[model samples]
Target: MIRTRTQAFRLTLGTLSFFGATAFAQDSHLPEIQVRGPRDATIGTADSASEGAAERESFQSRPKLRPGDIVEAVPGVVATQHSGDGKANQYFLRGFNLDHGTDFAVSVDGMPVNMPTHGHGQGYADLNFLIPELVSGVRYRKGPYFAEGGDFSLAGSASLDYFSALPAPFVDITYGSNNFRRALAAGSRTVGDQTWLGAIEIEGNDGPWDVPENLKKANAVLRYSQGSPNRGFSITGMAYKSRWTSTDQVPERLIASGQLPRFGSLNPTDGGNTQRLSLSGKWFDKGPEGETTISAYAIDYQFDLFSDFTYFLNNPVNGDQFEQTDRRRVFGAQAARTMPTKFGALDGVLSFGAQWRGDRIGEVGLYNTENRERLSTVRNDKVQQDLYSVYGQQLVYFSDRLRGYAGLRGDMLRYDVQGREPVYGALNSGRGHDAIVSPKAGLAFTLTPQHELYLNAGTGFHSNDVRGATISTDPASGLPADRVPALVKGRGAEVGWRFQPNEDLTATVALWQLKLDSELVYVGDAGSTEPGRASSRRGVEATLRWKLDRAWRLELDGALSRARFRGLAPEGEGNYVDNAVERVFAAGVTYIDGPWTASLRLRYLGPRALDTQNTVRSRSTMLLNFGGRYAVNKHLTLGLDVFNIAGKKGNDIEYYYASCTGGEVVSGACNGGVNDRHVHPMEPRSARLSARWTF
Candidate 1:
């Protein structure tokens, strides 16, 4: 294993090169256009739904997907729903803290779109702005296993892929749920054997929060590609524009009042607009040196926001209150080549990437003069990193019943970061670089053509700096905020079995572990700094499938996780009192018969932070969905989805940052119990319905 330390100015320079005047038209694809994840894409596997439970899974079913009503179908996943009243609209993942890096990573085709202030946990994309009809596929992956584009990597990665699969051009329009409505159009064509694909989506909805979060959005994509079966190249561009009425978060006190916001009113926290743009490309060539492929990408995110409760009334007598806006961007590149060798096949991948971000931060006041202020704080930070890796896997045919292989990759990377902002204390950027020589190895033993056993081990890392992308200060305290630590270093191990008892049945089970240097807490006072302590995630996952002779199929999946922080310190904010959960269980079942399909899912959340004491609580949720696809003549299939048949409410624990002061104040209006002490509430229930026609 050879670990590398050289920085990649190469990725940056290459990203710019991709935008030149060069354009290649895509050739018509015959059957299917495959869209996949970083790791799985190169491995030649795209059957994620058919993969036994032991492997990583995406949040959504496929790539190039757009979905609104679909979020409710997955186990252990939920969006803060409206009770048909168009109220609070927000979503949480894994009960971890909800913002930016602490939550799930959302991207489009492997390019990140999350706003710049990542460390403080501010999510860049709001799901409500997406139009369901424009989607091709949405995928969410758990754990830190696969190959990803860049930073905020602790929570895994979720990706969105749009498509050009139909005949000519088409338009779609729909209205349903929460007074929700959407309009979208997408298609592709051929010019001189060159394929050209393009799509545009727009959507808006009134959220169900008390002070409802209203949202609107527009997104567009254009692509060009050309090649015969042996060689091909593609170029693409995407842009997104979104606006929302802020739903100011409630103080723990008001939440205790059992009061929700009123409809058609200003949400008190944040509202306004956010936008993003991205460009990417890929080249594939069949060569004498096996198969060669190259890819590159870049993205930028910006947000303009306002607070719900104005501190300044734009009056001449007083300045504006605490309103703020930020602009952030991240860019990088990757290149790899795969060739067949005598020892199976050898794959060499070199990933070179960098990130640059600037926060044009200023405070504007509203209702109160004491709070009104427009302080422009400029922050510029950049990171240059490069990775060198070599992995090989060989399929061994041990007799006729046994097969599988040994796989491994050696990796090395370095990160350098520095910049200055008006907020004094956060690091003025540091050489945040460390070289880790990590190794990966795996093997599978075949018992019979119908049965097999597999074992695998790999290592991964979170950033080293405790402070992440966004450097936030408590508006009241004027001190830095809390969130997931800068880097979480760890490795994982897994052992599992796959069996095919009969032509109609397949089953799989595995045990795995993930150990970390610093634990992640998402509770009353989230992000405790526990230096050198290693937290661990241990569990078992399993899946079962039955393909009855023909026309009938059934699939079931389940997972149980035990996650915890060890040797945590209370004084220094150790892992012990953090808000994240200690254990969890998830299960899903799907059945397809004829042109109709039905599914049911259940998630069991074990003990988790209920208060600052880290008091643990328990909750379980169930969901049922039914869908039918009738071929109204061969070319068109009618589809429908139903969710939350049980209507159960589940809570994902939440928290904030606090200076224990033995209990003393760090800065301004932030003080004492309620405001500083974190308080989290359960989201309500809501429903959505949709239909699609494909030609």
Candidate 2:
């Protein structure tokens, strides 16, 4: 068996090398052409009005205390974790608490990272599998004005690209407060016109919570490629696994009554384990007048999570702990072609694309548990979901200073669900199908080389869970329920402007609004879908970047928003959308000179309403961080990172809920009644020291 495994590995490597070499040989004879006007004013796509790019230089200088922090590079986005290091981070953007990436689409190396119809929640995106050192660049776009964006992109999208080759082989070791340790080894080599890159990472951390996170994580990546990102064929393989104990949110009454510490946990057994393995490839060809690109991927993913949100909210005897399990295989492919053309007095580029994705889920289950012991099953079933999309876009230049973009996309989705046991109230075996057509348009007017204005409008949608669309009874309450449509629609519009008065400064401002047809969503915790009223949101964002000198740079970004239900509430209820953020601000300064580099950043999250009545709210939070690096020699470097510089006492997340603790009832039934505040506190001040050696 060992010999056979070795032979298979060798064959895979040989095939990758053969294709890389062929691509290199074909491009080697092409003539070099230099023709440039101004850099592409549009960021990722022609219709994108609020898009930006973060290059390797910014990645290298930023302090990434956690893997998900990398996404903070995008303006007006904030990343925070409410559970453990191994779980997905909570994201907030554009006035919405994205809830683990529900409204934002994320992709890495051309492979979609967001999971639809997940056991935990819809559009669960876990960035823990990423290795910061491997990221080459990140391009972010806010709004659904681009045809290339599909599901979970109503609010925005981010694409993370990895480097095909490293500048040099390197080993890095880091140690920090709270018994944190990490090690990484990465290298790249060129052979016969092909570049092969490999990397491995191991990390462990025991956070500040009383339960001690005890997180362990491992990641590995392998790739072979030739040529640049614009025109190259690359094959990649990745593997990641992690396990950790979580300190879930605690009730405020428990701390106020001295029943538990602020960082204490009601159920110390709460934890999770996850794993992912993927094989993916991308091929692209660029010619004088056109470009063609294709990408394909296959992934195996598994997650097992145990959580106890309400101590005795539902079951006073056994406690309210439960387990969620998901195991699935995902396959997907995309192809696109672009060609430059001209009409009577117009110049333009026409593009056409198609995408297909399918998920085969073997087991998605929810079970009642106590102290990690399963007591009964709530629901268990198998799910199969398929999505297909086709789109066409045209970018026309009426003049050197004016451009217009128009596109249309059509998506078809099918869902199939099979119940494992009827005793658990699982949805009966059934199938559901839906289709949607989205129209997009935009205009960009360049008043001069340094000033521009843009107007965009688009429609988008997010798929509903299959179980929700077919279930006749709630798994937890066992009551008659209403089924939701297979898809929910959203419409949005934006107007923005960009100005660069000189080489030292750039600024952008945008105003946007979005309306959702329905707010219905599957509540994973309750094992049912919650019907909601339609809602509307409007917001403003401003960003500025300034180069103080050759060695210093500064950035500032801010956002403000308002969200409310479109219609009046039934009786005494309010129109406010619960948990919608109202304000956000971020600022950063960096200095790079000689052999030293340093950066400092500050982030703020404003208060939010915790309930539709607007009677309760959460407090705001602010944090500051600092990072510095110094070169000791030609092949060695030393670095330090400090987080929460002010040691602020603030919560990472806050919610309003009801629960019973220690067999005591606080003005309510033993099960649950009155609402109380629940919070997850931010970590105290901490620091990490690192040393790296390169060859």
Candidate 3:
């Protein structure tokens, strides 16, 4: 059959790759080629040993909305739902917030995802662009040694590595329900053993949300590698474009009628787009006493968005023309070597890097520009930072039961002001450079061959700009606006235990602590936009994993966090809202039988108090999601997935534009004087059925 030709092509490509590596063996002085793994160049390994096998397989079988769900399985990590699909959610680690998490670093194929201030000012890391099915592997590091400069990361980093190797040719396509669907295709062939790869993927989700809140995206990648364990060079290039909509939630009464989360939804048309490119290099050669390895990478990320935010009185109508963009390029080179020591293996890696960023942000007032009313310019201010850093670590193993590591880093940090646009800064002064040093430490011990325990402690520092930390500023200063927020230092600790009794199962438990010395915080249209120093949180986290005899498997994941303010009060868009303490809990369970997989998810949030004396209470609610899949044959599969199964009572944060109604004076009681507006609420129960085929 004509269709068989494509399958035959894939087989031939795989076969060629299997023999190509061996065919080039005649070159005795070939340069060694190593695809980059997680960039933990900060710490050296315990011993100089052969590198672990490179994993060329994607982490999961599929990545359409229902298939390759970027599942998080680890202790001390929680995913926060941000409306729409869980795919757009954020991850919290070690009691620290990853909404622009500086303490937590995240990169994909070495591309930075965090917004460098500016863009919508609502910019955080958006990891949904790449389908999990495209991922080569993921690296999770906690408690320091990860020097990600954009955001503060005292807790850890989640580095996503994309496929760097390519076979001759391949194609994968899938279709699903709820107007949900996706397609992926790629091919790589060697020109005399110099491999070149190209891939493209597209996905769309009609979503449980109604109307324009739906999401769609397209991604493409091209890569090349040469030399091998011998000599040569390699390069990779990728381009991605995505635009997603967020429909603000509406009252339950509207949703019950099946008209909300869409057109009937409170507010619709909340959306944005993103694009990025990255390159990496490696060269290794045998040395006199030890081996020497050199590596380098350059990454650039850019974001563009047009969002619609909920509004109140005195609110400009153009409802703040939302435009947030970031341009950052970082290049660094690292070298590491291993030498045998009397008591243990001696190893160390040294890395030096330079970071450059350009951000453009502007808010178009909903109010008429013809009205001669100058829309308040929050920040046309552009802040730039120059970063240079060096770090080294030593791994020592005294016995099979005992091993430890210690590392330190030095940084020469500097800053510059490009323009005097409206910006948030500490006190308005444009300080150029700030010097900070951070450190890290860790130890691992094996109680038995099957059990291991580890403790890791690390510290991180964030550079601060005195540009924007206030609300109203005097125009007479004529000084460049301080749009850049202040930076701070974070101290963190992680103690964990893991056991792998057999190949069938594994378990892990851990306790984490993070303390912020002047932790940084920011908000919209509030003030200078400089990070507020009055914020900090502490909590404990844990996780579990079990596989029951292949066909039947079950897993339970949950998180309990006690997060609140250390001691600080700040004003919000509404008087009833401020810097108040709050708690969030997200947990779920999954079961896989035969070709069918079912899962239940639950989210519990603690009671939240109003910022004002009115004392409005935000009640907690639970959401349930279930899905099942059955493979009818070799190339086709049927599936069903649903969200908010029980139709739980959705929650929202309210602000009073009206005054207090009854009760005692200053009671903040809404005795009918409920002058207010509602933000988005949670989604209600909705379902979709899908069918997929891969050839």
Candidate 4:
């Protein structure tokens, strides 16, 4: 295994080196595009009012503490962390917690980032490898109305694109409170008909915790490309590795009783390490016949994580610390074509696509551990999962004032599992396959050149973890286990309005609802599936953006939602869905004058029920952040960012669960662990200063 990984690394490096050397021999120049405000000008061009894009300018002036926070640019999305910076972020959108990106899809440069049947969680998306400086734009959509989206796109999706070329080469260095340090170098150059872009990043941080979350990271990207948006080909290579000590959420009672600090951890040995290497390429062509695109990718990924969420709840003497391991190789390919055609006397455009993905997991396991040392294996298995999809859509221009589209998509999933443990191996090993078909439709009416109304409806589905679909018996105990369906179905609909009264102002409002057949999900932390009730969610969202002259811009957005389980509930259990956020609001003001730029943003998260009974609720949180930058010269710039400007004392996340501290244990067992709120506190006020040199 070691030799194989080493060879793969060498091959990737050699390919990048060869491309870089070849591109340095020729020279050409291309002008760069001017980036605009926080939101893209998508009035008449948008398929739905809830879909929009954010340009590079929108990200550069924001006070973001992590790369995943870039997704927050979407109207109602929120990104927060409950563990170390190296772990995947927790996300919330449209009344869904979207734990580790389960129902929300995210991709970078056409390469999928979500991991299926992962060790930590299904659809685990870790953006720690992303270098924010290389991003060009983020295009986002809400609801399941697009035919091209598959898998985890039931709630929403976002696609991030990288700039094909940079106006100038640059280097950035930054230092902040809590021992945060970072450095990044990136550049792009055109040689003959091809362009080469490269970047490297290094960062370290010791968070303000009693355990001191020590984080170290290194990342690099290399790309070779030729052509424009209309016709082009490009290839990219990425490598990243990170390790960190985590400070997971702790029982709030401990802090209340002065037994532990708000930032203290019950187990200091909990941490994780991860590595990812990938190579991807894309080819595009446009002609009188149509426009076509083809893309393919291969990725190598590995992760090892140790966590102790319950402390001594499970094992009094050895503690509850355990480890999750995942190592896999992923391969995928996609092809699409769009063509203009005439349906009788009507003019329309037809788009069709096909996709294939396969995951070859060498080992995905759960093990009991003490002080990060493995004690005994609970379950160990190897899995192979493959997915195939095809979709087609037709957009018809019924008339100058009305346009509509209809689409159909089909997907098939197949998996094979092999248990490596001695006792549970035979009982858990199995093979399974499933298929699904979804329909999508949308209608838009142009009330005027500046106003539009839209109605969209779609069906979508997400696959369950293969282990959950094939498990016949419990690995830890000899109890029979019921298998969950390989795929869960969902339906959603939305009505929206978009108004662009003038070039300087744009506004949008949307009402949407979604229903899922079942919420049954695999619990990666426990190596088992948790049965869930069917659920429904409905929400309203609004966004407004106005340019108060060319130097100033104002943005405001908010969402209100309600989520509940369907049908009858248990006697004492209410219909409320735990942790389903009900309200979110954000506002920002940006100012740019001459060579100076500044922005201030406010974010609010409303309180929500912590359990089904609604007997206990969580506290609302609000925060303010500020950022400013000054151009020293054409080639130099300095910037400052301050987070939690109000010094708010609040939690990033809260959960109600049973856990025990050492003092609560007796005779090698926890006496019915106490059920209490566990919380991870928000970071205090802190600031960072950075300097960038452009050449």
Candidate 5:
């Protein structure tokens, strides 16, 4: 370890002396030597083999239909959408259906993206505002074995880093099927000691639904920075707004009987609008003393959504349409430091960090509605929630081939709620608090120059909705309701191995298990949280990357898992966890030669249980996407991307539930309503063409 200034100086002097002597003996001219460090290495420098980083160039040619697909670059992860494009994407990993990012954490440029206690859902992480072109790389970890991971990181976490400066300014424009259009402009310039970066994006699309989904969106980003990553400061501002019409899932019975089209909407008026504005800044420095980083952010957000999943089931006359709204401001800050350590001839590092966040919600409400008009208010409330966390971790090299890590973390959460409505607010107004402590440990052994093994275990937690943690009575039924704890705990363990036979091939495999004390289940129709049973999951994952030749590269990833409820249920209920993903596989090939770049990707999602009984299940899906780019000249490039290349028919999502489709009454569908599989069909094959110009 470079523990002191004197040691660092001595090492520097030794290297300079050797190079000077070599130059003097060889010739009059000196030979240049470039220094590189292991800033993003997991095979030998990490505690777990499952943690790694993806460079921007690795996925630059990937064909993406939605911005959230950026997360798919992480091995064994899937991102899909069931509603409009503007909404957050549904995520699945480690046998868990991470509803809107509930168990998986996401961040961009040191700012959290997962919103706690959102109107639509808890941990609602909308990535539509992301501009893929501006991202430089992604760092990811799994199994909750890291002290840096906080809320919603039980299964995994991903962090996206942006480029400080671009090689050149560029403008990109694209047009595709179904009236899709997009334009983007981005660049960076240095002014004296500081650099300024700016980007803007505008997009619109009409999908292939019976009712056109007129989606419109806009996004902008501005940033200022100085210095380098080891020593730097930056401030950034972002703005995003979007509106879209949604086509929710339709009943299989209705579609089979010709009563509804596959992509038809029961309520054409269903839609939503949302906006977000934020400012964030960070500073960091690394020297002989240590490494330190500090960051802070403030955000203002607004959302409004209208949906009707069970049409005519609750109110036959009004069609069961309803609205959910959320308006709030969020503030947060975090700081961390790492220092070199020596314990009796052993080299090591000690790290610690602190985090604080608060959310002030002006109003969060649900309403009964018809079309787009609100008929009556259901419940409205104001809430303030605050969270604080601190953690310490240490890594020590026990021998030349063995290393060990240990960490401890503590977190506290507090919330206050006030009912804004007269009748409903009076029944549910209250306050609550909760706290938890977690510990983590890991061991790594280097078996050979090309092989390494790891073992890790840790505990993590996610916060429940403020309303759920403080409710005294049910807003809809006026019945006594039990309040849930502010935070729920999770435990995880993994054994992994990494192999690097040469510079051209790398492989990794892991076996992992996770258990949750309680799951957070959000009821969209009622805008409420319902308690879910404790669950356990175990899975196997593997990834491989091979450079076949200079121009050809191949990548493959696969995962299989089993998930089950922990305790016995009702007589008819089974132990299976609903919507738990069972198997996933992905493969891709890239060809880069001269001025031509092309890529092809294949993804497959296996069947999954849709009900606890293990009876109702969702169908499998397979898709292929292709992309190719040709450089017209040094200043211009043309690209073509084809999604769903084989035109395979599939469903983005599926659910088994009871819903009334109006015709159910005449058709005597199950007496009360129709109990069937509801599905949101995947988008059809589409082609997009783009032109990029550099100046």
Candidate 6:
């Protein structure tokens, strides 16, 4: 094992020296192009920012253990997994936990990735189908100030664009600790006037747990495209499938008492399986005065998850294991038009867009199970949910130094739920509809050629689960339950500034706040909607990037925030938002010279309150990772990645809740109050080595 940073650095240098002679002999010089303004000005609006074309190069040189980690490229976003790898990762950004993409929208190649009203969570986004090497660029926005962003985009949004063609064909194989193995093959070819690209990936891993994760996954993508984004058409198909055993969170008291190890689980049979198949198409046209874009997609998806959070708290006989299943087909389409326009003495642009989506779910249900055997059903339902939206925006340039933007959007949601089986003879079958209108405005002032100031305010919302919107009875108790509205509203505002002091340095700072009407969620475990109180969050973020030289770059990003429920609580009880992370920091350094490249990154997640009351808190965690690569010849290259290089002892996730075990009884009953901190510890230090052959 590599023990220290110095040793790792020296090792990397030594390896580069061994291959330097051969690498330099085959090196060729390339011409350079320089532009005068901000590198991202062309791709970003006043309220947004783009990662730029260099982002693809950065991704190629970095090391990531999972495909979802690519989101970390977005400043102030953090990704972590608690359960099986097959499930969507937990995301944190801008003072929101963003549980499984709840408040963050994600898309790839004009296709939406977040699933609404999912069995496990709302807005579940799984990126396991993505092939990282195929990504061409990433564009991100921090607030809901853009007219194009809709549901689940209150906090932020990210769009990933894939390359239509590859520079060359390549095959890569990787091996790592903990029985990790991966193989990938990708290439592109020109057929007449169209470009065709194909890629496939297969991977497996047995993580460091008493019960092996045994994760198996595969992904494939095929695409055909002609022309460019300004005028182009493309059709793509994607398929992904995965299965894994999970080590769910264990009580800290159990580990403290030597009853369970930090990496052990009370229920060893917990796991899940998931699959997604999709077909999508995109077309764009650029005319003398305007442009138009159209996109359409269809997807079939299924998920089955078995989790035992409280071993015997709810059901002593069955051990509290439960299953959540979702099977659905989704269809969606979007169209947009942009054109230059002027009013009186102002010069500007006008844009209009529309989106339509529908989800037909065959069965979304929850069940009681023991050792993966179903015992009793809680609620089984068929749901049909549809959403339609139309929006328009106008950008007016008052002068060379100032500009203004205004937008209006309206959305309508319809929900239908049919109960397949009732719990306790109580059935819930109903239909509901809701409509909302949101407005957005922004102002941008150019203080200098390289400095800009922006003020933005916007309104956004997330759709409630169809089952929650229509359910009239609680499946757990068979009691009358209040049905929630079909949609929840959110409003946000931000004041930010961007500065580019020189060609090598760029910095940005923003102060923002957001308020939510209510935190309503579909409790998949209970098969009902749980209404929460109104809440507010305020935060400040700062980001900096410096290219110290032609071969080295450094980046730093940090955010701090406070989150709370608005209503006053009873005396002695706090109103803190549970699990709302307050601080995050990330720093990285990258070096690239000739055929050698290296990167080192540090990430920190600060302590947070685990419940409404601040008595219980979590510990902060910090990690370091390193990656290095060397080109051996024109057709061959080698790479190494070290994760958690310091072997930090920390938890990937933590929660405060009640749980019971067979051996432990409290008050002559197997019920433990809400005092246990269930935790999933982080993985220990591990490494992966890879070889790639290019043709």
CA lDDT of every candidate:
0.42, 0.78, 0.45, 0.81, 0.80, 0.76
Question: Candidate 1 vs candidate 6: which has greater TM-score?
Answer: 6
Tens-place lDDT digits, model 5, residues 56-170 = 5557778889998989888989999887888889898989888788888888767788888777778888888899987765667887787767888888887776666677789
Clashes of each: 64, 0, 52, 0, 0, 0
Global CA lDDT computed for model 5: 0.80
Q: Which digits, one per residue and each the tens of the lDDT, describe model 1 over residues 650-681?
A: 43333433322211122333243323322323
TM-score for each prediction? 0.70, 0.92, 0.71, 0.93, 0.93, 0.92
> Which regions of candidate 2 fall more than 4 Å away from where they truly are?
1-46, 227-231, 424-427, 520-531, 665-671
CA lDDT, candidate 4, residue 265: 86
Better of 2 and 5 by lDDT: 5
Candidate 6 Cα RMSD (Å): 9.2
- How far residue 589's Cα lies from its native spot in candidate 2, in Å, is 0.4
Model 1 lDDT, residue 13, Cα: 21
C-alpha lDDT of candidate 6 relative to the true structure: 0.76
Please provide, for model 2 over 443-532, each residue's C-alpha lDDT reduced to its tens digit, 9 standing for 90 to 100. 877666677789999998877777878888776677877877777888999999888767578788999998888764324235223547
Winner on TM-score (3 vs 6): 6
Candidate 5 collision pairs: none
What does candidate 6's lDDT look like per residue over 128-224, in tens digits? 7788877765556777776767888888877666666777889999999999999999988876557788899999998888899999999999988
lDDT of 2 at 648: 96
Error of 4 at 272 (Å): 0.3
Q: Write the per-residue lDDT of candidate 3 for residues 1-695, one digit (tens) a residue.
A: 11132332232222211111110101111112223322211111211010011122212322223321342433344444443541235444544444333445555554445543434333355666664544554555455533322344455555555554532244555444446666777766665647666788787776555564456777777777665543445566666666666553233333454644323443354455556656665444433233344556665655544433322212323333334444555454454343322332422222223333333222211121111233454344445555555555554554445556666666665655444453433233354655567777777666665566777777776544323333235343445533443456767666766665654455555566666665444343231124544334545444434456655444444444443445544554222223232454545555555666656555554554433343555455555666666777766667676766787755533222342211212353434333333334555566656565544
RMSD of each: 9.1, 8.3, 10.0, 8.4, 6.5, 9.2
